[model samples]
Target: VVGYELSNGQRVSKDEGIQMAKIGEIAGVAVATRKGNEYLRSLPDENENNNLGNLPSITD
Candidate 1:
């Protein structure tokens, strides 16, 4: 995903969200690295219905 739309309607870039997550500004997600690229992953839980992949895309 290119970015995320916060609940307050603010759109933040992937890197920005990653930075926020690092400082505990965002919750329920953990920072991960793959092939030298940093990314975000939802914390493991029993809820299968709210995975990040399941969220609707913001086309704007």
Candidate 2:
């Protein structure tokens, strides 16, 4: 994940940046899926069983 520092000296994940990248990578697949492309839709889920890393603290 991408990150950035805030003015108060705190770090935050750059969700928008990651989302944009994901969208770009999936754009073609999304279009093909919408156009009833069976091959694209048949692709396996790369992160289907992936975990979200360690859990975050409440204060985080």
Candidate 3:
């Protein structure tokens, strides 16, 4: 997972998205750490189809 395509059709780097999420500029996501690396994770919800991993992939 390199980056994300925002709902507004804008693409941001992973670091930028992390910062946004930290300041509450983004919603429905929480900052998480795995294996000493930080990343964004979707808040648990009833919608399985909306999971971040289930989203369509994009290319640079």
> Over 4 Å off in model 3, which ranges?
none
In model 3, the worst 10-residue window by lDDT is 47-56
True-vs-predicted CA distance for residue 5, candidate 3, Å:
0.5
lDDT of 2 by residue, 4-60 (tens): 333355554555323433466322222123354222221244654322232232234
TM-score of each: 0.87, 0.24, 0.92
Please give the lDDT score at residue 41 for candidate 2.
21
**In model 3, what is the error at residue 50, expressed in angstroms?**
1.3
Top candidate (lDDT): 3
Give all candidates' CA lDDT scores: 0.85, 0.35, 0.90
CA RMSD of each candidate after superposition? 1.1, 10.9, 0.8
Q: Please list the residue runs of candidate 1 whose C-alpha ends up more than 4 Å from where it truly belongs after superposition.
A: none
Considering TM-score, which of the candidate structures 2 and 3 is the better prediction for this target?
3
